[model samples]
Target: MLRFALFVLFGSVFAGCASIQPYYTPNPDIAANEVEDYEGPLDAELVAGTNIAQRIARREAADYAFIGSAAFTGAADEDWTSAMVRLGRTLKTEKIDYFTWYAGTDTATGMTSVPVMRTSFGTVWGPDGPRTVPVTMLDTDWLPYSYTVPRYEYRVLYYKKRKEPLPMGIRYEWPGEELGRRIGTRKALEITLVVPGRTGWKNDLFDGDVILAVNGRTPTKELMRQFCRAPAGGKLKIWRDGQIVEKTISADPSEGK
Candidate 1:
């Protein structure tokens, strides 16, 4: 009876140890060097007119047109219409078109339970004296694992038509490239277009101009947002032809550009 009790106690201890141990395995689906790269064309092409000139004319006639694209990070099951409405409200515009959406790879890590095999070697009493026996048991325990996952990015081209004039008559890169005149000395955000004769304010700013600052402050994301929301115009410090020049911007409240 005492020997049987010892065996039961030994089994209980082995079970407890097995339950506490952990096992881990690599997730095979995600590779170490895997990255999300978007090679497709941006949703900037006009959806209305047939030729470039006609497209520009149609866009100018519209109250607002999506000139460029912006991206927003969201969940896999995120509702797109609601997101668009929210974005429009934030930008103070109701018109949006030329929409594009996609998902990108992200990484997630967590601990989870996994099954493992536990083996034990011990001695047991038998009719032929002490006998060695090998025992194997299937068990489950918690382990840490990491892998790449898919996250959604919502992108769209939006336009706004309002009587209020636009603060600036230029189209800038939303994720703009940083340009410098003297390497580390003179830096500015690259501007893509300055519509000729479309600006509300009177200034000598032109297309391909690099903006260094706005109203004497360094241009930042928040500053850009302020510019977008501003009904009136502001000052712009531009880098043109190896010189920094200040231009006073005005707003045009007309329906057409």
Candidate 2:
């Protein structure tokens, strides 16, 4: 009888402890009304280390993925096919934390597509690395001037030896190697093209010398357009080693004149 009474008393004590005041409180940073904002368990979905592929996949589905239309030709160093392959490989590896949205390329023309999303998502990774969406573009009037923005976005416009290089911009790099940082700038396309001998690009007096200027203008896009109608083999002045070099064209060079 004594043991049974003791057991009953212990059970009563445990039950009473179980019903103690609800004393657990949230930290000051988290407001009571904001608890619903957390969708998943805490600390479960953060990206800790480098998972290049996973990051790309998540960004691919994000609304901030390349939006609208971006030029996707194979003329430059990075063409549509190459970009798609790279991006697809990135998506295949990364573990997705959330279903942000989707981005695609046009099947016909190979243009890159923009992100489609319902709710706002955060930083997403690309083949390059993690990136945040441009929050400013969400505003109403930011559309019209936007077209000019990407044109000047510096990229390495790498092209074939004979063709023009394309643009591929990077945000950060090692110190003192900041090249190809801008596209539409005045000197963005500055390059040294070697001219062949005795050809239209050769200097008149100095054999094998380059035919630098065309129609009294330097080798620039604006100048080329102005002299478009002029015939090839036209007289041009060039500067080499800070000296004025003159050349006589033997044949007409198209496009670039």
The whole-model lDDT of each prediction reads 0.49, 0.29
Off by over 4 Å in 2: 1-191, 195-213, 225-230, 252-257
lDDT of 2 at 32: 29
TM-score of each: 0.34, 0.23
lDDT of 2 at 244: 58
- Residues 1-257 of candidate 1: C-alpha lDDT, one tens digit per residue: 01111011234444433322112122232222321222222223324322333333344343243333445565465444344444444444343443233467778899999999999999999888998899999999999999877675444454444243333555454323344524233445555545555552245666567777878887765576476456676888877766777877765545232
Per residue, candidate 2 scores C-alpha lDDT tens digits across 54-77 of 433233323112111112222222
Over 4 Å off in model 1, which ranges? 1-165, 174-187, 225-234, 250-257
* Model 1 accuracy (lDDT, Cα): 0.49
| Candidate with best lDDT | 1
Model 1, residue 20: what's the lDDT? Answer: 25
Which candidate achieves the best TM-score against the true structure? 1
Q: Show the lowest summed lDDT stretch of 10 residues, model 2.
A: 165-174
